[model samples]
Target: MANLYDLLAGGFPIDRDKPAFLLGDGSAVSYGELESGAAQVAGHLIARGVEPGDRVALQAEKSVEGVMTYLGVLKAGAVFLPLNAAYTPAEVDYFLGDAEPRLFLTDPAAFVAEARTAEPLAAAVPRADGDLASLIYTSGTTGRSKGAMLSHGNLAANAVALHEIWGFTPGDVLLHALPIFHVHGLFVALHCAFLSGAPMVWLPKFDDAQVLAGLARSTVMMGVPTFYTRLLANPGFSGEMAAHMRLFISGSAPLLESTFAEFEQRTGMRILERYGMSEAVIITSNPLTGERIPGSVGYPLPGVELRIGGGEATGVIEIRGPSVFSAYWRMPEKTAEEFTADGFFITGDVGRQDADGRVWISGRAKDLIISGGYNVYPKEIELVLDEMAGVTESAVVGVPHPDFGEGVVAVVIGAGDEAALIAACRAQLAPYKSPKRIVFVDDLPRNAMGKVQKNLLRERFGSLFMA
Candidate 1:
């Protein structure tokens, strides 16, 4: 039986002495070392009575040991559920109550404090391609988070597709700094490197100085838009500094066109922006070899099909592919609602494909503000606000309004004048699309992946128009 673990293990370097991960603390784990560590962790998991299909919830800090735990869960034929380390105990309690995992892994101190115990199984459980590999919970911004059930095939297919598209080779060194709890970091980043036998320069988190230093020795760097923006702010980060680098990829949030242009001008390399969600590991990516458009998420990956539904030019983006997840864990009804009768997952994102087949994301369907019975896409207003002087980024949302039904509200991150920003919006956008109220903050509320928590923004200003 072909398992995802078996596929990943196939990429183990012929020379086992080769480094698998170069840790932040100046230690390197060889391919052979990683295999041994993973095997030991798998033994521990099996000994703890983890059976095939059982959920193993892990909420430990990002470390070499944590990645081994993930691989061990796979080797044990159990479902891996990696929760954000930043999640509070109450939030973890909710997840535990919801998933009811067979085992929970945390820090050593916390494990002792909880006083949980388990016994080993007699043997390792067998797994197939279609079996559940993971249950990654979505950020519960709008409502309760749903656990997207990713199958072994779903993960394997995505890894294979990315390995080919990104042209990952053993010669490449991945500068990994993103959180491992999310799809981008854990699946997309780690899988590509592991499947290609490529070594990774792993960091605890995104530190501009450390990343800049790492770039000298690293060939590939994958990060969010914020990472690029912060790097651009540093005078030390120059085109010469990244001359040895091969590729720079960005995702997890919308990459502002201005930021994209500025990065290209500074680094002399265009960031390859891609689009993906927890339901699908990676759908569309700006081509690795071809022209990487600044604003577009280039083209759909091999084996994935993308189409715009609802409107003529732009609507809800729908997808169907082997990489798409099977279902939302234990939420059959919600899962059924998310997919079309023909099997296409109705991705809640609103987007349009250009004449060249490049996809442009407008905004989320829920983020579209219907003010005065007029449809207003927040991305349109946000684009204008982001270009204004003194503005870094902006999030536009809909607030309840008695007459208009929903009024447009703009939350900005910079010290831009509210009246001037509103005036600027009025100059560019239609009157109904203009922000009725402008809220300024030092920073926008974001999830672990750097995506703006629009639902939280809505909740904060939901009653603004009512007043």
Candidate 2:
């Protein structure tokens, strides 16, 4: 595969004057205009001395400016590190120090005066086959954040695969509202859109009202489960939105079964939930026409290999594909542990593939709650809780127990009769699988990635289970 920019160049020759992006603000930019604007930005970065392989960090929201900044960094041959727009200044400083970026790009309104005084670096044409084009930081549930090194090849291959698998065409209008710093929005959304010459509708942040408006003209909409839940609650949601959509994809976090059921009932369209991460843009997705299972994330994408690693250690989902990141930046040991000898990326997720080829994610390998010597996946408990009346969300963790070694404890968000809810659990779940202790909270703690931080729950309530 050639450089990502080279792929853009081919698209450029086809019909450069065609519209490429349609902003939420009612403005549209043509591919010719975008290419020209990016070229100017690339020239500016070169004049400021940004060299190839050096990191250029972007701390901005989803806007035309943010898109330009990303393309500029890539065109200049520097690796782009797009930070979450919600990140604090201290968080920005951490990435700046870790990645050792040559330049920090920010929205003019958001720019801090200090960045202006930093020294500039030289820019040069990049080697398309080089090791690093982007350094994406994972949520670091295990510990501190580690940068996943994505090469030009890794990104290019993934984008092409998605374009083929999803049947994306140049005329497809993709509605994007997720944070661009993550793979769901960056690779699966933007990169795929760009490679296919698909037009994009951009929203700076997720707002149910804004999303509903964009869906008026969009052919596809992609988001996490939380986004869907919020949209379902909106009074503006009508069956018409589903009629205009060709594909509706979900990822970054699991789609709760209750949320899926509610969405389909209201809009008359079953969402297509897929599985992906920062390491590999996407591993699997449900078929376009076949059964779109409620909780299953579906089969592997074209050119992607997946399987459950069985024997002694079962249920660990492993992947081998062109889209997989080459390694974790500056962490050889950690990268070595994440891959198998044959080059499959060992995903931390615990899942199983059914005979029909549908994939069901049970839980995270690290989040497994071992109570009374039996392994209990938290997802099972959460699923049960989500189905119960009035329960909005739930988190299950292992609490200490002197008798059983560990006990199942559930932290939930709900109202009304607590005793009645427990009775409902008794009717459905096995006694051992039921929560030994239940705590009601306003909201569960979630990281920027929208994953529940069960570690925080374990730390705060672990002592309660002690004898």
Candidate 3:
């Protein structure tokens, strides 16, 4: 079987009775359930006329059913499109219009229940290396979302690389609290456990109380910067509590140097941070056994080619790797513009690489806001705010946030009602993408060329969240 599911499922323990997921209720979901559940889900899709290469969109809360549905989508050779559960109908409308999935699942539990009665499909659908595995929608600078097309080969290679580099084993237990809508939780984290046949102590979301309890039973944990900060704030998260854990990995947002240092001081362990995007799942990762440094994303994985663009000491990061997505869905021109003539994908991140090959990300060339590990694009919200009745124009920028890595701040050049504008945004965009604060201004600071100086706005309101 060429399906990505085959590759992952092949690594399962010979004894299917072994647990694959250890839930909070003291019960366990065995690896055998994954196999049978996926088969039935595949049968359900096939019965619904879903074919290989078709899209299957899912917008539901995280649960065991959600994980099983993801596996079922792969087994059926369909592209899995996972949307944020927080997305409003307005935001979800755009994704549904763009991707046009053959089946849209809003109720994962019901779908799994329905799938249980379907005839089991004993084998996975054959998928070629170039066959699409997923469509990850990332908002563009133009306020439109582009679905990054990931292939089976792309995921398999990245999963294998990450599984090997992370030193995962059957004995390791992963503490999973991250959302599965995007790459971090959906692919990077899940693949590691699947490849090693390791069980995950699954938590729906990051809660201080639940995580503290889960940590005691887990050996390896993966999370974003916010998770670490929240855990640190809890008095219960002492070094003694995390002493049983072997590794703590962080990514999906920039981990503040202060938090990293403080976490080490409190826990007696340094959190390994990595760099990635929707285009490429995991580009660079800090070493497992070696010294993990603060503010550095460490070295690129084996077989990944990374270089700073324009031959400058510090410039845009460019990469060519098996894990990198081939192109934006249905946007050939856009895809062509993003890649260099030599085929390296422009990562749109401004950074530098040391002579020893370690990479340091200074900033993003694109004004992307990663709030609480979710990618929130300013242009997406700015477009909504600019069209409001009382707003002349708006500039959205991300400022420092204590819990969330960044907080969205909107500065407008009109006499718009602040509360009304925020309410409108909340109605249209997801909560994380909506502006936390709205500042009415006489005029937006602009460059001599008349372009809005978002940098200046960021500086002005940078202390709002911190203070």
Candidate 4:
């Protein structure tokens, strides 16, 4: 049986009495309890007519029961599809309609309670390596969100690689504060802990005080750049709090170089930043025991093959790996279009690979700006804007221009003289590369994962150069 859960089950502590989750209230969920809870939930799914290969959708808040439900779905030989809890009714409607799951869980706690009455399933259902395990929807920055079909082999491969590369041991305790809806929290973070049979310190979401308190007991923490930034802002967080921690892994968004430097100054430890997407859970990661360079996502995993698509200094990223998803669920045309005939998936992320195979992402291919027939990469411009006086951070976008086909526009997060900012860019870049206009705001719009939504910025300022 190639069931992913079986692999996780095999990794559980030989003594099942060990804790699976260490709670803030001094309570703990034992590995034994987790196993039985999953059995009951699997039995409930079977009783509810959910068959092997059937889709089960979940859009609910983070909870212990939610994790149980996920494990149970796998045990029942069903495909698990997780939707963002923060999504609106209409947004949820689209996902549910598209996935067409046999069961949709709105309240995980209720389901857990109902499942307890059911008989526990004796064992996990058998599955092949290629059987679909989950459907993770993309961020939908430039188009409709596509459901990436990840298989048992895909999840297992990535989990095993991460568990080994990140060095998760039985004694490690993970401080897990991210939401379970996304890949960073659910697949990458949770999978590692489960694969190592290590316990996690669970929180409903990222809270400053809770995270600070949790740091005292955690051995490892995997979170987005925003988590680190918020911690830096809090006065209570200090190097001593994280002194005992072994690793801090960041992903899901770019870690600003300033944040990286500041964190090292405060904690005397460099963060391990990785690169990944929904299509492939995680492709490249900085070394756990080697050089963790700032702004670089580091090397590809052991079995993964990566290359720049256009053979240029900077181009779209393409990869072939076991961890890569099989296809987009029910979207044959879109699926075929995303992958090359040679079997590499075109990641649509513009980046470059160094001689040593280290990766540096510039921006999305779709986010590329064209002004006066010259190529303008937003990341290149954003880096320049970010260093200017009075600018905390910046998002560069291309808007309609009366003269140039498209005009460069900078949506900044702090106050600055527009002329001086534009002048600064012109001094460092070509005239066409400089922003035609600069707009200051309190903050840039970000998604649930802390990624700046460049599409929204383009829409908001699309009419900037029209007049």
Leading candidate by lDDT: 4
The Cα error of candidate 2 at residue 74, in Å, is 1.5
lDDT per residue (tens digit) for residues 1-467 in model 4:
47898998889888899999989898999999999899999999999999999999999999999999999999999999999888999998999889999999989989989999999998899998899999999988777999999999999999999999999999899999999988899999888998889999999899998999899889999999999999999989999999999999999999988889989999999999999999899999999988999989999998999999876888999999899998998999998898999999999999999988899999999888889999999988888887777988889999889888899999998897999889889999999899999999898888889999989998999998885
Give the whole-model CA lDDT for all candidates, comma-separated.
0.87, 0.80, 0.88, 0.92
TM-score of each: 0.95, 0.92, 0.80, 0.98
Clashes of each: 1, 6, 0, 0
RMSD of each: 2.8, 3.4, 11.1, 1.0
lDDT of 2 by residue, 7-94 (tens): 6545442688777878767888888766765666666676677777889888776666567667766777878898888888887778
Write model 3 residue lDDT over 1-467, tens digit each, in one string: 29999999988899999989899989999999988988899999999999999999999988888989999999998999999887889989999998999999989889989999999888899998889999998734334779999999999999999999999999999999988898889999999999999999999888898899999999999998778878888888899999989999998866766678889999899999998888999999999989898879999998799999998887789999899999999899999999999999998887889987899886666677889999776656766776777775677889999999899999987786788889999999989889999998898765221346677788889999997
To one decimal, what is the Cα RMSD in angstroms of model 3 from the true structure?
11.1
Off by over 4 Å in 3: 139-142, 367-467
lDDT tens digits, residue span 1-467, model 1: 56687788789888889998887778898987777666666767776677889999989778777787788788889899999999999999999998899998886234322222433222345677789999999988778999999999999999999999998999999999998898999999999999989899989899987898788879999999999989998988999988888899999899999999998898788899999999998999999998998778889999999999876798999999999998998899999999999999999999999888899999899888888889999998989898999888999999899999998999998896789889888998889889998999888998888889999999998888776
Candidate 2: segments with Cα more than 4 A from true spot: 108-126, 312-314
- Provide the lDDT at 150 for model 2: 88
The TM-score obtained by model 4 is: 0.98
TM-score (C-alpha, index-matched) for candidate 1: 0.95
After TM-score superposition, what is the CA distance of residue 11 in candidate 2 from its true location, in Å? 3.4
Which RMSD does model 2 reach against the true structure?
3.4
Ranking 2 against 3 by TM-score, winner: 2
Better of 1 and 4 by TM-score: 4
